[model samples]
Target: MGKITTHVLDTMAGKPAAGVRVRLFRGAELLNETVTNSDGRCDSPLIENPSAGCYEIVFSIGEFYHIHGTESPFLGEVPIRFSVEVGQHYHVPLLCTPWSYSTYRGS
Candidate 1:
């Protein structure tokens, strides 16, 4: 079985983005919602046994910065859409700042 996991790094702060809200969706249907831990990772996989299909993970960029004292963040929300394959682990990590962000497939 395949699994989906994620973590967030604050580029500006040079640390993990703890307490950030994360939401997972299959198309328009929400599958799960979670918050990042102190290490900027989820406690468990977002999808322990995922099927092959399109999916999305929405990160609360604006809210995270606001709590960290950014009065007006440039990026409000960051939503990443990707395709999953059966029996493959998908590690979609977010490296972000208030102004920009990036993601890629990881081990």
Candidate 2:
């Protein structure tokens, strides 16, 4: 079965980015949204049986940093755009700081 999941780790705190709001979208269409758990993972898979198309992950970075009491200029949203092939499991993990972030295909 095709599936997609993600994790977020706060490098500044050396822990998971718990309680961070995450929104998934397929182009202009909103698919689903949820908050990350203590392990920085969504409680459920973000997508399953996803068609071959473009998907974007919106992470509420500014708010997350605020909650963590990190100094920030509120640089706006963090969005990661990726494409999924048919019938595959996609794991995207984000390692973020208050000012910047990075993501890649994860196991």
Candidate 3:
């Protein structure tokens, strides 16, 4: 089975990105949506597909911090774009800071 999963860490804060809103989309159309758990993980796998396709996940960083009452300059939004291959498991992880973030293909 082809599936997708993700984990998010706030490098600057040195913890998981809890309560971050995650929006998944296949091109312009959304496929699923989820929020980060306490451990900074989604309750379900990010995606389950058979073959490679364009995908995007948007993270609501600004709102998360604002609601929690933190002085943040994260710009409030981040998006990660990637593709998955058939018969393979893809792990997409986000390492973020208040002002910047980074990501790469994961296992």
Candidate 4:
């Protein structure tokens, strides 16, 4: 079975983006919701047995900045949509700042 996992990095701060809210969705249906820990990673995989299909992971970066006192962050939610295959692992990590963000497939 395949699995989905994620983490956040605060590029501006040069550290992990802890306390960020993350949401997982398979198509239009929400699958899981979690928050990043001190290491900027979730406690466990978002989906332990994700089937082959389209999926999305929404990162609440605006809220994270707001809590960290960024007044009005330029970037709001960051949503990453991707495709996965059965029996393959997907590591979708976010490298972000209050103004911009990026993501890619990782091991």
Candidate 5:
């Protein structure tokens, strides 16, 4: 079976984005929700039974920056839409700031 994982980095802060809320969704169906640990990594894999389909991950960008003492962050929830294939391990890492964010497939 394939798997999916994620991590967040606070580019502005030059560190991992801890305590950020992350949610995974397959189509309109909610799959899982998790918070980033101190290292900005989810405690567990987001998708343990990954398959070929479109998926979305929502990152609470505004809230994360707000909690870190940044007021009026330009970005809110940042959603990354992607597709997974069978037997693939997808590591979708988010590099984010209050105003911008980016994601890419990892090993």
Candidate 6:
């Protein structure tokens, strides 16, 4: 079965970005809302039995930075949009900091 997963890493701190909020959306409809665990991974799969379509995941960056003690974070909501195909597992990993972020498709 196809699935979608994600994790956030704090590049500046060199650790998993725990407590960050993540939201998944299919088009304009919200799918799920989850927070990162101590490992920076959602407690459950964001999308299970996934189908092919366009989807986006929004990361709550500003709040995370604020709680982590960044007075002024450069980014707020970070959204990553991509398409899913049949029979594939999509692992979208984010490496971020108060100033910058990056993502990539992982196995």
The clash count of every prediction, one per candidate, is 0, 0, 1, 0, 0, 0
Give each model a TM-score: 0.98, 0.94, 0.89, 0.98, 0.97, 0.98
Q: Which stretches of candidate 6 lie over 4 Å from their true place?
A: none
Best by lDDT: 1
lDDT of each: 0.97, 0.89, 0.83, 0.96, 0.93, 0.95
lDDT for each residue of candidate 2 in 4-104, tens digit (9 for 90 to 100): 89999988788998988999999999899999999999999998889998999999988888876866735457899999999999998989888778889
Residue-pair clashes, model 2: 0
Candidate 6 lands at a TM-score of: 0.98
Let me know the TM-score candidate 4 reaches against the reference structure: 0.98
* CA RMSD of all predictions: 0.5, 1.2, 1.5, 0.6, 0.8, 0.6
Q: Which predicted model would earn the best TM-score?
A: 1
lDDT of 3 by residue, 1-107 (tens): 88888888988779998988898888898888899999999999877763678788888887877776768665588888887778788888888877788888787
User: Which pairs of residues collide in model 2?
Assistant: none
Candidate 3 Cα errors over 4 Å, as ranges: none
What RMSD value applies to candidate 3? Answer: 1.5
Which parts of model 4 have CA positions greater than 4 angstroms off?
A: none
Q: Which pairs of residues clash in candidate 1, taking residues 3 or more apart in a chain or in different chains? A: none
Q: Residues 48-105, candidate 5: write the lDDT tens digits.
A: 9787899999999999999888889999999999988898899999999999998899
Cα error, candidate 6, residue 88 (Å): 0.8
Number of the candidate with higher lDDT, 3 or 6: 6
* Number of colliding residue pairs in model 3: 1
Candidate 2 Cα misplacement greater than 4 A, ranges: 71-74
Tens digits of per-residue lDDT for model 6, 1-107: 88999999999999999999999999999999999999999988898877899999999998999998999999999999999997789999999999999999988
lDDT of 1: 0.97
